[model samples]
Target chain A: MQERLYSAPGCTSEERFGEASAAGETLGERMRRSLEQDIARGDLAPGARLDEKEIAERFGVSRTPVREAFRLLAANGLVELRGRQGAIVREIGVNQLLEMFQVMAELEGLCARLAARRITPAQRAMMSDIHARLEAMGEENDPARFYQINLEFHEVIYEASRNDFLAEQTRSLRNRVGAYRLRVTYLPERVRHTLKEHAEVMEAIFAHDAERAHAAMRAHLTLLGDDLIDFIAQFGKE
Target chain B: MQERLYSAPGCTSEERFGEASAAGETLGERMRRSLEQDIARGDLAPGARLDEKEIAERFGVSRTPVREAFRLLAANGLVELRGRQGAIVREIGVNQLLEMFQVMAELEGLCARLAARRITPAQRAMMSDIHARLEAMGEENDPARFYQINLEFHEVIYEASRNDFLAEQTRSLRNRVGAYRLRVTYLPERVRHTLKEHAEVMEAIFAHDAERAHAAMRAHLTLLGDDLIDFIAQFGKE
Candidate 1:
């Protein structure tokens, strides 16, 4: 994955070299992480074939670990393993992506609904703090930092829902679409829109308005989905 | 797996012998199906250790297939593979079950909402047809058959959503909590309530009222979850 960092224009050379030297992870784990990150970043395009021998050689490891990593990726819906052809990154078509977003909207809405009713004072405060941090990132036009903080903001709500299973499922679904979602986050208008949406969700939860919280969260996700579709239509052509 | 059938008084001796003679499925596939059914029926019991050697002997198959079946069950979240301790029927505590039901309600509601908006005339007719069959089963007071048909009825709505990904995820989550759901389906009153709830959802869809359809489905699932918890508390004493 560090090797692929050089391909990403956003990363500084110093950062790339620093990451290259970090090698604490096991071979199979590193392979899995690298493959996942590449797929998520569209560095490795959808439907691209991943030859085990090629990946092994690139990572300077044996084919055995690469095969194991493929299994992990397959289990996570990141790749498809063809019998004779080996592995290819799973291609989520527009319709499927829309379907996923629809489900994701509902899941996030459910979390906000529960969080509104069940969130403690401390959790509510944490949400406010995260919201403030997000606003600061937005003002600075730092999408990269804002994107990371945006995840933390959502994580607070997931935790506030107080349902471990629901939180885990929601997070898993989020990860499934994480790659496509990353593209939308780079837009300045989207960052501004997200700040307002987050504020509405936080206010509803603070007021313990479950229905309002649910509606706000649903609206936020629906807008995000629409934005992604629009982005894909206009920018994806290139 | 066949040996466990003898312990279920619901099965006739003739039926048991008939099943014993059937051999179309591969050993591993048969074992997987049998174990899945047993878990869904609660015959295997939560937290019960699945000794591969014992299960292999009982199913008259080698441990290799039994091991393969374990992998299948683990993938489906039916069993947990604790390190060194081997496999155990996954124990979904009360909190986890509630969380699952909450998410299930949202997923079902999302399906109903989409089905209401996007269902074709043919799909609406199919839903009405399934509802009629469900009503007949309810009148006959056949809980077992009602349970089976009930699944078909919900499946119609899932497909009508026109989102394969959402439908598949909803079905997977349903299967995850199926064992507990089976218990609630046995109650005569619960069956009647389900009939009424199905009518509401079908009516809403037929009317093309997305909000109503969503609300009806969510209410139905929420009621089912509450009833399951109540039943577990009162009758699970044994």
Candidate 2:
């Protein structure tokens, strides 16, 4: 069943980009999105100074939009705007990274707790469907596909909480830690463990057991943080 | 004891203002601080439109600095920037308010948990002193003094966590909800209940019991949210 779903041509990254363009996003918004993707993908390293002139020239645009993008990025905690040094990709220190994961665990746990109580039947069904897809991706040992599906799975819980402010904050925090977290997805056995953990969270939510769902989500995130710290301890060697 | 401390005129609001002026803060930073105080004190009501020209003239500064102040306010989630209408004090809906409290509870709980494990002796002594002051304020039936002391009590825990990012984020969230929360602090019996709750949290932290501290802080904040909701439902009367 999972294989069939994976075989189908679903919404690819390119399609998402196309949709954004079709929606008539501003130049600054588009530049911000592109720059964010580059940073998250490690194409731009932490502490890399972003020159407005260089970025504008590279993108064949003026510096105004690039500067605007920097402001947007800085607002989201993605970049730091220095007085004369311009904008640099902000680095998360080890302590900060651990602290972020601690907060992320609580936020996600809160989402699961709320979702268990407030999720509509349709939303629960949607989560189950995504969970199934995630399991399939795990079985196929495709970390890349699993990572994307895993994000959608968590996003559904955020929406199910029916709290726009909470959802936005969670999404922003997730993005701030995304670059560091993305590497952890490639670790062996991680996908399998993640699949099991998602199952527990899904089952608890389906049963409307808020406490169980919260605990499951918190434990999952805590373990992920432990794994991430271990991976970093290995000097990020594959 | 708390009466003696309160009578000392320690760091009164006027003195704080004098200190800021003495520090020679930037015009934009000063403007941002002034606007934040207005909003937090309800001097500037929710959804009130802020005009750049008016603010600049009132502060005897240029429109350039006023615009910068607006950006800072927007970044802190205290104001909304509407292109043509300028900046407006953001009105947080009831649901969003509840959600913010939920997240705030978790963040503070995490701080307490970390503080239990990491707090230095000096930090612990400071928290104990603040907690004692809070109890005295409660006995004197001085909610106003209790309110100020209560903030310092939590600040001690945030600092004890030794996580700069987490501390900063927690402080920002607390400020975001401070305006709504201030009214609830005035409710009859609230100060007494809050004093007891602080004692439990302080005792747990002092004992180095991480789980107990976490639970105590969470329960305290959850009750605070419940009281706020009930207080608001009465239309904030009496």
Candidate 3:
């Protein structure tokens, strides 16, 4: 399989361009979304410099908004801003990637524990739907599609936990660490294993066994961690 | 007990101004430091608009660095960047404040659990020293000094955990929720209660009981939730 630059899949450039036409929004926020979409879609690369003027021209805005977008990115740890230096996209290392997965596991474990006790019927229905979609994709194994559904599956678990703050934070950290997850798509077996793990997690959650669900989620993330290390070793730049 | 603007008790304009010039850091980093100091010291109110030009002029730099600084702040969630509306400091309601403390409790609990297994002799000694200082202040009740030392006590726990990612994430979240933590101070008897809680947490960590340490930390943060609610009712903006 050929390696491609990762970008957020659902958001297209056309939609991003149309974002500039909206009113009452700061240029910073609009450009931030557009740029995040760009990064998500693999249009941008790690360590790439973000030229404020160039981006401003592209977005039909002043340097102010483009500059503001850069700041938001920097805050998110997506980019690094140097004093006299310009902003550059940050790259992830294997160690940092593993650390992120470890934290993600803990958070997922927490969500499962909460969801087991708190999940509503509607949320459980959503979880079932997402799990079904994810399970359907397991045989075909389209990495991107599987990943998307997988995200939804975990998100439903977070929502079922009935803790908005926990959900928001888990989502934010997930976004912050997206680069690493996307880069690990080269491992075919990883996809298969992840699908199997998701099945187990769903079963545990569905049974309302909080401890089992938490353990399953933790084990799933740990598997991702092991696969991530292998991918990074092969692909990581020195 | 007078309610005034959110300025540090001892910080004059000079001391606040000195933070920007004290180090030979880059413009962006220096500005970030200055802004954080202001926020921590209570000079910048939540929902306050940060005008780029004005901030640039204040720090004797161009809008470039100030804008970069804003991005750093936004990343930490100290401010929100509305697309065209400009950046405003974020405000947390009582429920949101409780959410933050709940997450804080979990993260700190994780830290203590790890620290129990990993803490070194030097780190243990440092923690003991910090606790002794906090204990000494129990009678004097010096809020400012106590607060500073209290921070150090938590820092040692995080560091002892020996996970860079978890420590950094926790520290960042703690700062992001700084305003709310400050609000909790106005609650009656909170200071005394907090000191007592700190001692219990320290004792657990010292005894190397991971579960006990985790429980103590969680209980401490739970009390903080009550204090924060009282503060919101008494002084929070409508």
Candidate 4:
């Protein structure tokens, strides 16, 4: 295969390099991630056709890999492939989003329960460190940095659960529902309240209080779900 | 693109029709389902190379579709794409299988819990019918029919949960771990025991006992995990 040139004039050298690294990953893996990012970033409009040749050319790969990527994306419910019409990005509906958030709450609750029981001392300390950084970051009111810290906080709970399969499935669900989650980040009260919930979750985990931890996680997830519902109702009126 | 002929002389008419239907399904979807079924049937041996051209020819489709199929399979962790080295079927060992079963149990538990609260009369009737059919199949000692009925029983529980995201995720995980599950069917006692456990789960769900249903589901899933572990220890020494 010839070296495929990817020419997006607006992309910085670093952004191009990142895209290249992403594309250069195993075709299937790269394709899945690329499509996900595109959907998340709103590059691929919902209901837009994802032609194999077009995607392949854009990603500088053969149709083989692109097809595989589409398959993965379709299975994730991100796309719908009709018999002969080709694949289209799926527009997730409100009910499905709510259902996803419900399950996410249960999984996070389980994670917190398990983390309270099994997280190591080192893991506990790491959670503390992340919480401290988040506190510092919150004082500065950097939404982006707070978001990064927020991911780390939840990731600690997931890792501490000691269930690889659960962690992986949860991550995938989070990714699939990421676009709508972006709305929740913009709310000032949501940000402050989320930080407080993170602290409570961390405290419960550190104290090894299983029920408390589970409750905390459940509360946090419920708050997120409620906020998302409100956010969508107010803005995502499609 | 030229449509390839599947003219293998020994293939039967129904087999041909089946093949055509499978092939005629969107190439990507065909590849995804074929790979999934092949893995479930243990047709594609673990660590097996999933040659793009070989699959393309076998499915009577272009490599484009074949590659797309591999991507979905890889996403489900059935295959691993090694960059330029191509893709290989993943060989899940005992520990990983155990981990998967652990997570499966939690998800199923969640399903039962939700089903207990949300199951309608019609859905409850469906569960009863499935359980009755499974019981009758168990009496006949027909493993294949019993297995099919068993899937219906769980799927009923999934629907009763009324959470599409949870139901879909459970279905996908169930498929990914199915190859190992096929081993449990060989144990005669296992079938009878699973049937009895299904009764307990159904009874709990019928009574609208959320906690009891959740507990029953967890107990049933634990047995599955134990049985799979034992089966792997004795027969799956890979």
Candidate 5:
């Protein structure tokens, strides 16, 4: 795991290069998504200075939309815009990151519990399909593919929970934690471990054991001991 | 409890018209806070229409800043922007509201659990002081005072949790839920009930019982049986 840097697994179209994704989004939205993918992929490293003029030129857009893109990124908690200091990709503080993971574990636990109780047959089938694909892909998975599919796997659970508001809140927080979580996909063994953990969560849900599902999901997401150390290690230089 | 509607208990400085609150907030931000208060107080009821020209005139500003204010309101989940049909005060669907409350319960539970373990002397004192004030206020509590102090009480727990990320997320969701929860403050007996629930939560926190604190807080926020019935009833003419 130390020898490997996390990337995509069994990946396809990890970055939605062209889809507007939502109504009313403009050039700023496209630029934000593109820049987000770059930052998530480590092409734009954490704490790296963001030159607005350079970005404008790179995106082949005017400074106005570029500024809007920066604002949106800041709102998403991916970038920091200091009054005089301009903007930079945010490198989350260790304490803030730990707090985020803690909250994430709890929210995932909630989703798993709801999903266990409410999942429909179709949703269950989809989750099973994704679970099987993850296992079947084995060594061929790319960090990009892994991230996209893993997101889909979780989306199924969120949908199965039949709680749109909860799902939206969970997804919003996940986006804020995106870059770091994506890094885990590059760790080959971590992906394998994640597969096993997902199996445990899936089993609990399949058994209609809400408490067990919640516990399994919480255990899967909570970092302790060596896991926490690995996260701190992967977090780049300040 | 049915005859008693919620309101304030020993409140002061319910609305801060004088303070800018934060730097860089302009006329648009000021308008946002004002309108938010109006909506929360039921001066602007859910499902009410918001006319851009009318609001611009009322706020003594140009339509430009008013539009920006509307955008901010929509972002806060207090307003719905409907293209050429114009904006309306958002009346959240029952299902979405239930989902929001569910997530809110989980988040508050997480805070309570953490606060139980990490609360410092200062935070503990602040919480106790607020609890005493709420209890001491008796029948004198107004809706505004009740809302304000209750916020302070929760803020102490959030601070005590030593998890800024979780606190920020919880606060953001609370803001989105403000209009609805403020209505709860107007239910007089609900405030009394809340005081009892807060006492339970405080006891668990003070005793350093993490699991009990978590359960207490979750129980405090969760609407159950007739509580849910009353919430729907008080949701107003929607």
Candidate 6:
């Protein structure tokens, strides 16, 4: 069996990543998170079968809850249900990944544009604070920490948009794509380019220029030209 | 109680509104469509309680499927499951509606932009055909027909974007908002304005002007300033 899934992926950091968070979260949900983390970390490869009896015994649970957990996983697109073959980790096609990336770029751009127009003083300070931390990284490339912090930087903009529904949708999309991206290591040169682009987005938002913020953020994240070609190559290996 | 829900809301017109469609659709799914249509038409008003036994009797089904259907409704945001009290139709807040509208506009704009860049001759012809139908309506105002055709016009662009995932998401958003918009009647004046706006979108797409197509489509559909004000007033009435 796979794992249970959250309908709303993440409204906050605690809901998203905390191992033992969200009061009243069911046992199935916790197990689901453990399995989800395993999948994201590539411990469970794509197309790998999640045997019901095996997983149930491994997790020290009965088949009933395990079956329910597999249903949840299927709902989350983490697993595909085959008639008699139980559940298998979904193999995401490159076309679908590309489509997701394109949508994510536009949604991020909208968040940036909204943040430029609607950010509060505290939100502005938070953005600047994150910006400074990223800039402080200099030439040192740490993919793990960079990935974590990059998410924080984006989350700030999503929160600043002042639209919970919009933010929730964006976060759900982010969670869906996160597994694929987790497999890719950030290169030193790519990190350098990303730092420069972050500055461009930050400057636009600081000046309260919505159009510029939208354009700048789109440029920063859009996988086009060489970036897209590089992603396809990396994706094939994953 | 309530109705079952489709996870992927309307990947096509047939899946969205057809009574006899989608081969092998479950009995619960069929009942769901009837109830969903009832809700959309205001026959089942917002905040209405859906009694499990009563609904089961009405649909000539057992309590088991009724409960399963209610769960599906809750998942789709069509109903709220309140502990042991059973399910009630969900009440959407004004702020949430506005947020959804804003997101929908941007998604449609992205479709238009991509359509301009990637549209084939066949897609271009289809867009022209829909545009002609819309223009032919002229001052002969029919809100129901206009709304139906307007969706077709937008769907054409969505298809032309050549991204199935993006198109599917856009369609899902359209379905979510359809219930709310179903209550509003387009005045003759609004129809004239729609015609003018559609012409602008059509012209931009015909010329392969991606930026203009994006901006024009946003302008066409965005609920901003006066349009938003009017919508809020109308929404309150609904």
Local distance difference test scores for all models:
0.80, 0.80, 0.75, 0.77, 0.77, 0.74
| Share of reference contacts kept by candidate 3 | 0.59
Task: Give lDDT tens digits, candidate 6, residues A1-238.
Answer: 4433422233332233445556655555556666676666556777778887887777677775566556556555677876556788888787777887888788889999998999999998998899788878766666667877878898999999888878988887777767667544276667778778888888898899999999998887773324655866865754
Better of 1 and 3 by DockQ: 3
lDDT per residue (tens digit) for residues B202-236 in model 6: 89988999999999988877733246558778657
Between candidates 3 and 6, the TM-score winner: 3
Per-candidate TM-score against the hidden true structure? 0.84, 0.86, 0.85, 0.85, 0.84, 0.82
Candidate 4: give the TM-score of chain A.
0.85
On the 0 to 100 scale, the lDDT of residue A108 in model 6 is: 86
Put down candidate 3 lDDT per residue, B118-198, tens digits, no spaces: 899999999989888877766675666766887898999999988888899889778777766665553337767877887
Best-to-worst order by TM-score is 2, 4, 3, 5, 1, 6
Candidate achieving higher DockQ, 2 or 3: 3
CAPRI-style docking class of model 2 based on DockQ: acceptable
| Cα lDDT for residue A177, candidate 5 | 73
DockQ value for model 5: 0.48
Worst 10 contiguous positions by lDDT, candidate 4 chain A: A1-10
Ranked by lDDT, top first: 1, 2, 4, 5, 3, 6
DockQ of each: 0.39, 0.38, 0.51, 0.48, 0.48, 0.41
Instruction: Give the range where candidate 6 chain B is weakest over 10 consecutive residues by summed lDDT.
Output: B6-15
Candidate 6 chain A: minimum summed lDDT over ten consecutive residues — where?
Answer: A6-15
Candidate 3: list runs displaced more than 4 Å: A1-15, A19-22, A53-62, A207-211, A233-238, B1-6, B20-28, B47-71, B80-88, B183-196, B203-209, B230-238
lDDT of 4 at A187: 77
lDDT per residue (tens digit) for residues B12-110 in model 5: 112443455667655655777777766665566677888888877655678865665676677557888775677888888877777888998999999
If ranked by DockQ, best first, what sequence of candidates would result?
3, 5, 4, 6, 1, 2
Model 4 quality (TM-score):
0.85
